[model samples]
Target: MMAAIATLLATTTALLFGAIGSRGGKEPTRNPEELVTVPAAPSKPIRTSTVRSQPSAPIPLANLPTSREPTSPQLALIPKPNAERESLLERRKQAGDTGILPGVGIPGGIPGAISEPSAANALVSSLGAGVRKAAAGQPDKAYALEQKDTLMAQGTSIRCALQTRIITDHPGFASCVVTEPVYSFTGKHLLLPKGTKVMGQYDAEPDSGRIGVIWERAITPNGVNIDMESPGVDNLGSAGHPGHYSAHWGSRISAALWISIFSDAFKYAGAKYGPTQTSTSSGIVTQDPFESNTAETIQNIAKQAVRRAANRPATVTINQGTIVSIFVAKDVDFSQTIKAH
Candidate 1:
């Protein structure tokens, strides 16, 4: 029994060893949980000489064609012909060679061209001859000659009827003599109405020699007599109307006579009072103390009043007592005392 048991044990041990060797020979043993995987090495890209299958090849920026620099066109400087210069020189030569016409040599359009000792001598000769011839004739003929001479003298005076008529008929017309102030005064002063009719005559004074006429008129209501005289003859004929000798003679009287009288009255009033002041019914006051430069101030006030009056409704009437304040540049203020009704 012991031998038989030993044989079975040996067989069993040999079978176990054979089975272990078979399993080892069939596959290598490893732990699946601890198994490691390795990746293959990357491959290098292949270089090829084949052209792309599209259209044209792209041009390299450095190899592309460039634009050429611009060039200015050359110009030729040439001188122009001077036909006009030659023409002007010819015209000047022609003008220099020509002389003025006979009648035009003397400024007047008179018929005779006699050379006299002097203009004054010629005038005296004409007057004396005319007077002597008239005195030698019949009484009626002498009287007619005197009338004609008187009419001629009056027609040449500065205070001619035409000028006086213009002044009277159209006081506001620019060309009329009456548009400008005849007289200005500081206080309430009386003056002849602008269109008042007056007569003027020439007065020859040997001492205080003048060739102007005197205008005489009565101041209305006051009944004061006013007279205006013109400057000397030398100044008169220069006024362009030598034909109207009386008008030229009376020009100074017409322009300055009333102005002087008015200025005198203004001076008297100014001396009597301190300064002019005016007030409106609406309580607006204007002080006319003669500030150095009040013209601008007064102008600005008038402008503002005009603007305000324009903006007012149509129903509103611009009348006396209206109050208007003008604000000019900084620090300048003007208040107007309305005068128009």
Candidate 2:
């Protein structure tokens, strides 16, 4: 019982303190001086460094190197020749020499200098003159041919006039001369001047009684003798007739035989039919007698026909002043070598 009473008394005392602490009250004020604020002290001024500049100065020429030559390998300058060696150069210079030095291996050496002509130069000039004279003295090819002193290639044709008259019935052979000038194919060069000669032979044809000719050789104006074959009649142009004849001698013989038989038959018929009458010499009777004997005439005609039937020789004839052409039969060379003067 005593413990309970003591607990009650403690509880009562705590309750009373709690109630007092819980009650509300007005807030209290502080001093105004304590609330006021003060500004900070001012900072010290800042400091900086300053710098100054000066103008540049010029360099002097006396301090530079004097030489302009490079350090690399190059041609060295040749020293002036000694007085003894320079005598030749001085002599050349005195002669108005303006070009490279002769016989010396230098070009454009000195101006206002003259040089004497050497013996070699004079010799060369003489040789040149001689060569020119020789060339001028050479004969002109065209002129030589025009004068007939030179002949062109063979087989060349030329128009020539006959100087001699030829008869078809001439015996064996005759020489004919060409009197007119004959030109070449182009008529620009002469083939034969005047007086070129040719020889020919003629033969007769028994059947046709025709004549033919054959040329053997010719002589040139320059005295060159050339052999030639017999030329064709057509190649002679209008100068001669073609050498040909028919071989029909039997036809002539047969015709002559028939004429003789008819004549005999006519005579026999005239003798059978006659008129009888008294013969009187009242008027001079003029009887026309045939001078030719019938048998004799027939016999002569037969003989002539027989002769014509045999082969006759061939021949050709040309009249005077007739123009003819002849061609060369072989190659001819006229070129000759010329030597140095």
Candidate 3:
């Protein structure tokens, strides 16, 4: 009983050891090999349709015209009639019955009016005769006589003929009296001293005797005395007699040369005096004889007067003196002493 029990115990122990060994072999001690991975080729890149924006159109200019430009219109050139034509027309109108009209058969008459020659023709003839007489006689006297006759026939006085004279004893200064013929009650006459630079005027009728106004006297720096006279007349018709007219007219005569000298002197005086003021009753300024402070007033006044005289275009005269009348104050009293020269 005891041996059988031992054998059974041994067999049990061996069966248990075999079962433990089978379990250890199935679990192994070392780790498994790592897996190697190969990367796939990159897929072809996807293509996108590119849409580029087109550039915008340019703008147009404002001033430029799309069509043809319009053209400009043309102007006309035409002339009008002059004053001579108008005068001829006026003469034609007055030819028939107007007694005041220029005499039809007179030397200056219209063409075909009478057997007598035209005034223009007669003037030419007289001029020719004067030339011949000057050639044949004492040239100076004959020429002077011819000029005197020409003045008388023209109903105009020579500058020398209108002299009312003033004499100056001064060494550097001189002057002469002047006179004008009165034509009508309302007519205004201009008078300039003998040897005064003056412009001339024309009259339909001849000038007459002079009437007295006032006298002026002045002394020069060199101790010379100057005397002057102003004259008036009732009517030029009263002076029709040649001797009577010439007697008074002779007093007003001045040398043309002297007159020119005096004009220059006057200009100098004006410049020295500065601009003179002329005012009316209302105190309104009328003439400014002076230019600006820098410019000369006297010269300006003289220039203005000359311009006015020349602008008349119909006549030739020294109009500068007229500016004095315009610029001088009407109400102001001038010293006779100052005016005399």
For TM-score, the strongest prediction is 2
**lDDT per prediction?**
0.36, 0.53, 0.37
Per-model TM-score on C-alpha atoms? 0.15, 0.32, 0.13
Q: What is the lDDT of residue 287 in candidate 2?
A: 42
Q: Scored by Cα lDDT, where does model 3 land?
A: 0.37
Residue 196 miss distance in model 1 (angstroms): 2.6
Ranking of all predicted structures according to TM-score, beginning with the best and ending with the worst? 2, 1, 3
> lDDT: which candidate is best?
2
- lDDT of model 2, residue 7: 95
TM value for model 3: 0.13
Ranking under lDDT, best-scoring first?
A: 2, 3, 1
Residue lDDT tens for model 3, 58-116: 88768865764334332111112464466556656654333223435466444323334
Cα lDDT tens digits for candidate 2, 240-279: 3333344445565576577667556555544454332334
